[model samples]
Target chain A: MALENVALEHVPSGYGVYVGFFRDVTNADFLHQQLLSRNRDFEYAFIDASSVISRLHLLSAVYSALNTLLVGALRTPNVHSEIVTSFNTNNNIADAYRRWGITPGKTKDLIVVKIISPTAEGQNGFSATSARTPEAIWAHLTEHVMGKPVPVTDSEIAQATDWPKVRKYYRLNGVPALEKVADKAEHQRKMEQLAIMGMALRGL
Target chain B: MAVPHQQQHQFPLPQILTHPSSSPALLITQGAEGRLYKTTHLFPDRPCALKYRPSKPYRHPILDARLTKARIAAEAKVLERCWREGVPVPAVYAMDAANGWLMMEWIEGVPVRQAINEYLGSGESQEGQEEAEELGDLMRRIGRVVGALHKTGVVHGDLTTSNMMLRRQEGEQKGVLGGEVVLIDFGLAMQSMSDEDRAVDLYVLERAFASTHPRAEKLFGMILEEYGKSFKKATSVLTKLEDVRMRGRKRSMLG
Candidate 1:
């Protein structure tokens, strides 16, 4: 149910992160409110799982958020909020929330992320300095989330993804290189590439 | 690394990399148009080339921004076209035309110029017939790539040996010209089906080879041979190339 903090390769040192997937998240509204109210105690970035296509799709957003956080260029209130917005294709913060952020009763399966670096303490919050161990984060998430944690693997993420919505969100439909691939798996891989590119090029 | 807070800054960086969380971006080159940097696209594991066109100090601010933005957009568009057509160019992963940076797939390889020069200067049994054969293959590979680009209706405006790269092959040793040719530095690239444009592209490289590596210039005929066999319309382009050669590298204003 839990894995050690995952250190992304080639990233600046000391930035490890833990991702959790959950199905049947009944308390998404409550979690979503905590974010709307900007409650520091519930500090995890709660993403709507169905919007996520794969581990890389989710991690790509996290990596962009962290990179922005380091450079002091965060658009949202904090890195966690910035992570929620990073998955978006534009700088529209509220639209990003509606698209990828949890919608209480609407978001059934959930993707919860907690960055494990001292710098993630953001501008204001629960002084994440002392209680950021992987175990501590898992215990806190399970206690509040009220959903069973699933491993954040590629297949698991795929199971929760809404492909049609994914295509619409990332503008992947009708892409020539994407449609050229007949094989299903190969096609999905190409779509993911374009999707990630869309996210990366948002401001450009 | 071009850290923003460094004691002695060489040049101003794009606003994207100014954050404390901004990953390190290393300047790869500074052409007259702009500077290129090697950095991650989003995730650290995913490396990308960032081409940034800084505002020209001499030009009017409005005109400078317009030119920079248009160039970035045009470059990204051509790269995307080539990628979709399977023309063996770097994929345009993302681009911010307004910011003057186009993030593209980071191609890994040495420049064709460096590889050719290294082999020519290797002095390892220069008398061996195998060396000439190996060099001939390299030239053919370069021609094929150029042919592929032109076939896709794109003319690489600045076609020098440096813009052509030889991607390192698995288990292949270096200094042998044993790699696939990949094009780079499309800052001046454009999409055109014109025979004149394609011919001029070939002529530019012809001049580059003769001046840069006189020893390898004799083998460039092999490039044309391979190019002529690449596409249905390439022969006509090659015919145009002979005319281009007679007219010299400089195009006539009256034409």
Candidate 2:
């Protein structure tokens, strides 16, 4: 079946999942409200494949040289456009969810997978799934699709493998590690080194 | 004793009036030029805005003086023209171009950008979708003001939300007829009959709207529609505006 033809049907009756299709996320108010009327605490998600790839590419480059090498190997001349196409085709959805640690089944009561168009014009597309435990899916993505080690770093392991510290950290930071700064001094040091190295390599 | 109107004279650093008796009670120091003080005149029993354009260290003293004088004269001329043309701009009360200081009627109201944002409900969580139409209407009015300014050969160089003030009308003045929309800060304003200058002014405004307001395209479209209807000469200007929008404000070397 064509990917665009993939409709959200797995969601249970009486509950409606409204997907906002927009070129930009700023114009998703009407769609947000439409879903809100059906469910008071409707889940809000922004899945921009291009933005996701851009962020992942940036993070992959920053995190580890191995991941950067892997990404570089996988990347083509039109890597962004290729990833966008794959994402639109629903081929990369599971991998994307695993990368972000977003468990679809965990929030079956709410909406999921709100894909936004990768253009200047605001267009939104949405999808839903059945209420099944996403552990197997997550395991498959981590073990197979990623082809990289599960709980890639000690921090990820600490957050996913160890929940207490994660909860504590969230309580302290008011958001997850992904949102807030983990170590500002470390980040700053790395940034300075990168700058100096960049300047040196350019013979500046 | 009436304050003496100083002629084209030597540039001097403006003295900061701190005393409430001598200056206005509330002095807000905000703006690119320098410190902007909102002060009142006891003799006239009216409030006024005092903009003190600080001396630039980069330029030579002679060049700085000449530029300052030219800018002050240009601003005063534009404001006078706007006033005569029934444009809602601040009335220029006093100006010492030599010292890079301009005193004008202090407008008491929130900025139109702030008002529109507040009306639209800006925060971590959105709240005011119902007032979007009203906000749209106000945005169009601002566009009309810009269009009118362009028609009269004046360009508000820095056409941003912060520069536009929306004064609330007093009791029994609750409607549109009661309240006033006054354009302020003519420090960077210039007189230009060229469409390129006007297009750049509009481009600046468009960029400002995009940065300041969420979903500003629809709002800006409404503004453009109202602005287009304000003046007959605006058609050619609007067409040039499209070209400016396409190429952007910066001139491309390729062209």
Candidate 3:
């Protein structure tokens, strides 16, 4: 229950994607420092859950980043950074990190994504096994991240979602499409769809 | 003898579809600009239409890549714009314009061309007034969609029955010429606010509707009537459409 090894469709079997959700995260400043210092152990995309609309929204970004990585066109430093940048609807990496990435004191609920590449140790040339196992990643996350581990489901993510931030980030506010939806659940679904579309169509 | 099905497709697939997935990708249709494939690449339960514009061999490699990328980006941008404006168009799921592929929500139901043809072909005798009313309603739906699209400041350059889909409603009983009208195929679409561009769009559709559904060409006026009432400036576009009908989709150069 600590980490989920998402079996995303169309992704190459060589790569592994694991996601974890933590609520009421307290050691965000310490964790944020690890990312800033370039610690090898912290090679993960730490996202602020408030900006995420749903599991599909998060996975869309992951898929986009994975696609970019597969084609050898990753603009960010690594696949993890690319995943964070994939959440933005523009080419501003710095703004994406600040808005979606983990920030000290501000981000209460956190979403962490770790991408294990097959070619981790490039010297060996395309290793058959993933660089890290899901169990080890889960254990490390539970030990380090000071928060309650929650399942990465839509309902749970919805609890942490900040609608205002999401609306601003995806330009979902005042969208004619959403205004036409009357049902509450349908409205949320439409918002999620719009956000996913925004991320998919990033950078024009 | 490993995966012999890969050889079935007439053309080589894009790089993205070659990866393994729960369900096999099926080539749905092929157009001059690109090919459409139905694949569950985003989610196993969700299907998406993947439009891929393969590079041309005649053009230089760099030029072909640039053109393909630009077309994919332009198509995706227009789709997103229409979708945000509540226009009945497929929402973009994912796209890699640089890779010359765009993934969009797979619209269910037949193309408007097929539905209208089926309705018109069902009887040698004239369709009853009730049935005629049903077809008129569909035309109005088309009008509203095209009007909404134009109101969003984008013109669907390729306006034809084939480019529009009638989305099947879940609980509604299946019937010819039923369901919501969803516009598709925006490869030639562009953002424009000019009445001239909008008029040319309607003119193209009027010509296409006449040829594609000649039996029911008279009903085309219903579409224009609804379109005229849809937006603030639609009246002007319809007026311009009359001139376009006379000039034959191009401005005359007579001095």
Rank all candidate structures by their lDDT, best first, as comma-separated numbers. 3, 1, 2
**Candidate 2 runs further than 4 Å off:** A1-204, B1-13, B16-26, B42-44, B122-132, B172-178
lDDT of 2: 0.48
lDDT of 3 by residue, B65-109 (tens): 899999999999999889888898998999999889999999999
lDDT of 1 by residue, B25-105 (tens): 778888888888887765666788888888888999899889988899888777766765657777665565766777788
i-RMS for every candidate (Å) is 5.2, 30.6, 1.0
Q: Using TM-score, give the best candidate's number.
A: 3
Off by over 4 Å in 1: A1-19, A24-53, A62-108, A113-146, A151-191, A201-204, B1-9, B15-25, B40-47, B92-95, B124-128
Q: Per-residue lDDT of B1-255 in model 2, one digit per residue for the tens?
A: 564223322344255332213332344754566667666432234577777777789989999888876777677667766754657787664444665766666788888777766655545224466355556667677878888888888988888888888887566444331246788888788888787888788788888888887665567877788888888877677889889989888877893
A1-204 per-residue lDDT for model 2 (tens digits) = 001111221111222222221221232344334333533122234233222222222222222211112234333122222222222212343443333222322211111222222222221111123111234323322232211222222232222222332233112223221233368754333332222222111111
TM-score ranking from best to worst? 3, 1, 2
Pitting candidate 1 against candidate 3, the one with the higher TM-score is 3
Q: Which has the greatest DockQ? A: 3
Model 1 Cα displacement at A161 (Å)? Answer: 5.0
DockQ, every prediction: 0.21, 0.00, 0.80
